[model samples]
Target: MRYCLGLDMPGDAALIAEYENWHTDIWPEVRKSILDSGIVNMEIYRLENRLFMIMEVGPDFSFDRKAAMDAANPAVQRWEELMWKYQVAIPGGKPGEKWRLMDRIFSLQEAL
Candidate 1:
């Protein structure tokens, strides 16, 4: 399955640069955690302060499962805490949420 999500970074150029630098060499533990959670592929894009993410997951993937796993892993928890320094919940996102799921309004495959 594929999932699209959005987030926002602080509107500081330095902070945004730091965030991008971090992604350039994500920690091995963080990458391992994602793979173990059944995420086959992931990509992130940014437009000013707005960030977009696309994830492709294996059949066994579940957001609940991933959350539980992340909660139990100290490294994952640490990574999230560091990331939160530059991230904020998108407008209308639930409290404590960073990434907001995007709704697909149109798909060429569906139209065809």
Candidate 2:
């Protein structure tokens, strides 16, 4: 399955640069945790302070399960804490939520 999400980053140029730098070399532990949680592929894109993420996952993937795994992993928690320094909840997001799920409004597949 594929999932799409959105996040907001600080508009500061320096902070945005630092955020991109971190993604250039994500920690091994974080990557492992994602794969182990059933994610097959993930990509993040940025347009100014708005960030979009696309994730393709295995059949066993569950957002709730992934959240639980991340909460229990020290490295994942650390990474999230560091990332939160430059992230903010977008409008209408739930309290304490960083990434918000995006709704798919149109798909070309349906036209075929």
**For model 2, how many clashes?**
0
Candidate 2 colliding pairs: none
lDDT of 1 by residue, 1-112 (tens): 8999999989999999999999999999999999999999999999999999999999999999999999999999999999999998988878899999899899899899
RMSD of each: 0.7, 0.7
lDDT scores of the candidates, listed in order: 0.96, 0.96
TM-score of each: 0.97, 0.97
Task: For candidate 2, write residues 1-112 as lDDT tens digits.
Answer: 8999999998999999999999999999999999999999999999999999999999999999999999999999999999999898899987899999999998899877
Q: Please give the lDDT score at residue 30 for candidate 2.
A: 100
